[model samples]
Target: MRTYQTLTVETAGRVAIVTFRRADQLNAMNRLMQGEITESFESLSGDASIGAIVVTGEGRGFMAGADIKEYAAQTGPEFDIFQAAGMRMYAAIENNRKPVIAAVNGFALGGGMELVLCCDLVIANQFAKLGLPEIKLGLIPGGGGTQRSVAKLGRSRANFLLMTGAIVPASEFVAAGLVNEIVEVDRLMPRALELAEMIAAEPAAAIEGLKALTAHAVSGDLDDGLTMERDILGELYRSEIGQQRVKEFAGRSTTKAKKGGP
Candidate 1:
């Protein structure tokens, strides 16, 4: 419900959409924007009414990366502080209990692409351009772009993007597995909201558990991952909604058997 200068939050059913509003700057992440992003996601993660979140930007770009003009003005210690804040912002999205979907409407470059790397799913506009262009600026992604890119995309693809700073079409990464789907600019938001609503309709506990399990599967030891999976499964199985859904499914199965259906 709080107002933000850099972004706006609006809810549709159980899905919350956060839109970056600095259109003139391509919605670049200034220090204010970064802090607001961290605050927004962290707050939404705890909101019981919200089940999923979709992030996008207004006008021509999803995000053009950090506000370089602002970055240029920072002192050495200030820049270090900014880097630390960036980590928190990324973590707030990556570790959010509710699923976060990136609705990349336009250019997602440098730190912008890093933000996408934190989401649970990505639905990009067909014409959207994405890349890590930090190398061109004699810098590298201070966010999780270096690591998450390698994990989501293969090492070869991540290496190319990181090293060359190529801003390619969103479709280029679809086959690489970083993008879930690509749609016409007109369909981008509709498709994203459709997916978010579907996810929002699912059992919240199961969805949250699945999110944690998937994150662990990516980074934890195999044995530990398996144990975590089993624990989460057992927890879900014992939950009230889980038990009710199972009973309902079993009842329908019994009725079908009585009628000799397939």
Candidate 2:
């Protein structure tokens, strides 16, 4: 809802779409963009009207990566500050109360791929490419790329991507479970919004609960995750909308039963 120099935020119904506006630079994350990203997602996380969020980029890249020119100019202290801020940016998305989806339009290397790694769902354009190509710059992914990639993709695959710095096609990661779907360039935003809208139609509390539970299942202790899952379910079952939905489903089941429908 606020103006940004590096990105644009707009909403359609209950879904907010954040589009990176640095088309000429392939939407590379500069310091300004990094701060804006953190601000925007943090703002959206508190907005009750927005049920889901979609992130994408303009022109030919979802994000080419961090601006190498900017990175090269950073002093050690400046780089340290930048990295800390970057973590906050990633956390704003990954830990948001609402779901975040990456609509990867093109190249998503280094920090770009790390951005995707933070999202709950990812939909990429057919021609899109993604990798942690920071190794090519004599560096490694400072964002959660290495860890999240290994968690989402598995060790061997993450190693190939991280160690080699190879920018691979979006389809290549589908089997590894990193990508949820791929679509033509024209269909990219539409498909992303469709998924977002589908998610938005659900009870927000239930959706948030599921997001927390799934994140726990991925990285938390099993006993803790099970306890959390049960707690969340119990809470949801007692919620007004949750109770209404359950009753509606039961009513539908009764109608079907009386009509001898399976």
**Count of backbone clashes for each model?**
0, 0
For all predicted structures, in order, the TM-scores are 0.99, 0.99
Q: State model 1's lDDT.
A: 0.95
Residue-wise lDDT of candidate 1 within 1-262, one digit each (tens)?
9999999999999999999999999999999999999999999999999999999999999999999999999999999999999999999999999999999999999889999999999999878999999999899999989999999988999999999999999999889888999998899999999999999999999999999989998888999989988998999899999899999999999999999998
> Model 2 segments beyond 4 Å from truth?
none
Root-mean-square deviation of every model: 0.7, 0.7
Worst 10-residue lDDT window for candidate 1 reads 170-179
What C-alpha lDDT do the candidate models reach, one value each?
0.95, 0.94
